[model samples]
Target: MLKTTVLNTAHRALGARMVDFGGWEMPLHYGSQIEEHHAVRRDCGMFDVSHMCAVEALGPDVKTFLLRLIANDIGKLKTPGKALYSTLLNEAGGVVDDLIVYYLSDTHYRLVINAGSTDKDLAWMAERLCEWRLDVCLIPLRTGPTAVAMIAVQGPHAKARVWEVLPEVRPATEKPGPFFAVEVGPLCIATTGYTGEEGFELTVPAAQAEDIWNALLAAGVKPCGLGARDTLRLEAGMNLYGQDMDESVSPLDAGLAWTVDLASERDFVGKAALLEKGRQRQFLGLKLLTQGVLRAHQKVVTAQGEGDITSGSFSPTLGCSIAFARLPLGVAIGDRVKVEIRGKRLDAEVTRPLFVRHGKALI
Candidate 1:
């Protein structure tokens, strides 16, 4: 049986077209996927992201454990509610999972991991903790009495819409800059989001989720689904866990080199392997010049060599088919390439991976 979130009934009541997503029954869209996409881009929209797991690390050795666990330098997160984006890597420098780590204090931290990789991520962290013999406790926050549900409200007007529904949290959430989080009573509001827009990812106790979802809906926040989420993230040039990369792909090869820290003398799980393997491929964006919708795994033949599309779709904001491809390093922006689709080589142009941000087209 597939798992369902606390707001499953609410989603069904909204007439969401449900689909199985990584073993979780999730909404693909309510009525029109395109309209939901435009709603988030032009106005405000909300998504149920309760499937994602939240884990809390507590104990005296928390900082030590995190410093050697993920690839990014967690030392930069000095203030409470500061967040850092990073990847968990294996011994071979492959991406185990990407996550957001929020610092509450030296002895307390929170990690938000992808839903599909939750089990594997927890197991990996457990094994690492045992190996290091650290005095730390990993608490999975998706179940039991303290469970929480995540709601992501996004768009240019997202903040205002959220304020209308959660006026009490406005004082605590208003001052934080992007990537910062603030706690107000039962709410944990983060100025962070998956969509390339101004928004807050609200984490509320599971018991209060339905009320919050209804309040947001009553406040005129359009309910979006996984379909719009995918398109929005793709257009923002963000990498998906299983699609854009996996345990076999390195951060350097998946357009996520920025998330990996290799400068400092500090050693992490995959530092040595990352230094040894280096960057082999270039992760970039493609604009289909010919008449065809780009899809993943299509053969991309460039002057430098052949590559594969990692993520692709017709961008509603751009009104064209765009994709993220792992191409040869020599390929440059403005370079023309050919993608093999249905035995036909379709023309495409290489460009920076980002296609849209803040309701504006970058390409």
Candidate 2:
């Protein structure tokens, strides 16, 4: 059965082109995808991200359990409500999932995970908690009794616009800097977003999703769908879990080296295996010099060797084809490579993995 979010009816009412995304009925677009993408870049736009799960970890062993699970160090999140992005790894050092962990208190933390990863993530965390004999409760809150709903309001004017509808939340939301969260009554307002723009991702009671959604729309926030969300995150150079990486890909080899804190003496699930498996291929960015749509699974022919494109798309902001590729180590910035598309070869230039941030094109 295809799951539906709390705002499914609202999306259909807005004439959204619905699609089955990760076993869920999701909105592809609210009509014009280009306009929606630009709306987020220029103004403010919102995405119904209710399908994403917010798993809560409570009990005395919560912090210790997390330190032994994800690749990033949780100790860095000393400030309450501070969020840390981490890549949960499997035994062979492959990425199980990438999620955000917010340190709520000494014995409490909240993790936001991908919708598709809901089941596996919860199970994996449970197995570890049991094996470690930790006194912690890992509750998956996207479904079951504690289910919640979420929305992401993004862009340069995102904060101001969101505040217009959530005036009561303004005072508390204003204090959190980047990668932080604050509780505003029933809402968990976080200064975090997938799009490389300033925004807040709000988690509220499932029953209250409609009211908040309607309020944001009345506040002039453009309703965006998964289509614009995909392009926006891709242009921002953020990795999509299943597309850009999976259980077979290592975070160190997937352009996420910075998120891994291997320097610490703390022993995580995949630390030993990760340290053993050094960089096999380099993950970098590419800009096409030719006119063509760059898509995933395309072959990249570098001067040193061959590679495959992990994620690619026509960037609405850059007005060109941009992509992330795991190429041979010899390929460096300023180097040119050929990509195979439709059995034809096109030239592209190697650049930094990050394409844009804060609505400005970096490369």
Candidate 3:
């Protein structure tokens, strides 16, 4: 039983190549994947991210519930609409999932979690709320009136084009800060994106999904698919949840240590385990020097030891192969290494995990 988003029919009508992505039927590409990737880099492109779960927790105890459930501190959100990225960890210090939480008010917080981890994430939070006797109740966006279409409009021109299509969303986003969200009526627009470009992720009702999609299309925002989304995120140095990190992996090796809040003694889940786990491996960026397609699970041979590539792709913007690898902590930037691609060793170099941001190359 595969799930489908509100844009399922629209994607098929546009001649999109569809595939199973995390149990959801999703578009891999509409036509030329490289063309779609460039469209997002140069102009604006939209992706139907309705498969992602938008779970909202509300109550007087909501803030306290989150403070104990996630690795990051929700107390950091001093202002309304402020969003925080956190790793939801288990009792053993392994990552359960990485999610973005938005503070709407003192009693209301919205969590946009990965589609694959929704069930486990809900169960975990539910048990904790019961145990702590917190009054928080989790509400998934897919149910009832809260059901909405999650669309991502990305690129340097993304925001301007969004205003052209849905002008009503502008006044709410006037504060103009990164990692912040604004709710106008039933619409929730957040100034956050998986791609390293300026964009706003829109959450609108399921009934109005096609209308909004068409409006954006008419406003010159091209339609993109998961294929283009992958290439764009790779160039931008964003992590794909299941591949980059999982329940068996820790944030220390997943290039997500910054999201882990260890400054306070608030006693979040997995804090003790994380303190005991002295990072053995590190997450670093890889640029293939030789001509070849870098793929995941490929063995990387560094001078220190052998490691593996977690996520890899041919970057459309950079016109080269880039990947994220979990390597020995001693692996420094500018260190030469070899990647085993199809039994043939290829030349590569190690650098920082971030490759590009704001449509510009950092490496």
Candidate 4:
């Protein structure tokens, strides 16, 4: 059975093209995907992200348990509602899943994980607790009386629109420092986003989603879809799991070395494996010099050796194709490479990731 969000009818009413995304029926676009992408870059746009799973961890040992499970240190979150982005790793240092952990209190923490990986992630966390005999409680926060729906409002004017719609949340949402969140009534407003824009990811009760969405629409916030979300995140140089990485890929090979806190004295999962194979192949950004769309699993040929594109797409903001590739260590910035697209070799340049931000092209 395909799962539907609370706003399914609303999306259809807006003429959004719906598609099956990872077992969930989701909106692909409300008319033109490119137009929606531009709206988020130049103005404000909203996305229905209710399919994402939110889990809460409780117990006095929550912090201690997290320190051992994630690659990033949770102790760094000194203030309440502070958020940390980290990757869960297996014993071999391979990425289990990348997630956002929010510190709510001394004995409480909230986690938001990818929708597709929710079942596996919950099961994995539970099994780890039993195997390690860790004294903690894990709870899955399903959308119901206690849990709620989440919507991501992104773009340059995203905050402004949010303030206009829900004026009562203005004070709390005003000074949400980067990677921080605040709870207002039933809404958890966070100044964080996947797209490289100033925005907020709001979590509200399922029943309240329609009201908020209607208010935002009246406030001139355009309804965006997953198509725009994908393009926007790609332009921002963010990795998409199951495409850019999976359980077989390590953070070190996915251009996420900075997220791994290896220098600290804190112990974490997959630390030993990271230390052992940290200097292998390197992950980098690729700008296609030829007129061709880059796609995942394409072969990349460099002077040093051959590799593959982890994530690739035609950037709507850049008006060109860009990609992330895991290539041999010898390949450096400014180096040229060839990508095999549709049985033809296309020229591309090796460069740093993040091709666009705040409606401007960076590469």
User: What order do you get sorting by lDDT, best first?
Assistant: 1, 2, 3, 4
Model 1 spans with C-alpha error above 4 angstroms? none
Name the candidate that leads on lDDT.
1
Task: Give model 4's clash tally.
Answer: 0
Q: Pick the candidate with the highest TM-score.
A: 1
CA lDDT scores, all candidates in order: 0.95, 0.91, 0.90, 0.90
- TM-scores, one per candidate: 0.99, 0.98, 0.98, 0.98
lDDT of 4 by residue, 1-363 (tens): 899989999999999999999899999999999999999999999999999998989997888889999899888998999998989999899888999999999799999999999999999999888887877888776755876888999999999899988899999888777899999887899988988999999999888899999899989999999999999998888999898878999898998887899998888889999998875788889999989898899999988889999888888888889999999989999998999988899899998878888888887
RMSD of each: 0.6, 0.9, 1.0, 1.0
Tens-place lDDT per residue, model 3, 164-253, is: 888888888767689999888988899999888889999999999999998898898989999999988888888888899998898988
113-202 per-residue lDDT for model 2 (tens digits): 998998998899989988999999888776665678999999999999988888998888887789999987778999999889999999
lDDT, candidate 3, residue 1? 88
Error of 4 at 267 (Å): 1.7
State the displacement of the C-alpha of residue 245, model 3, in Å, after optimal TM-score superposition: 0.3
Candidate 2 residue pairs in backbone clash: none
User: Which scores better on lDDT, 1 or 4?
Assistant: 1
lDDT of 3 at 284: 94
Error of 4 at 202 (Å): 0.2
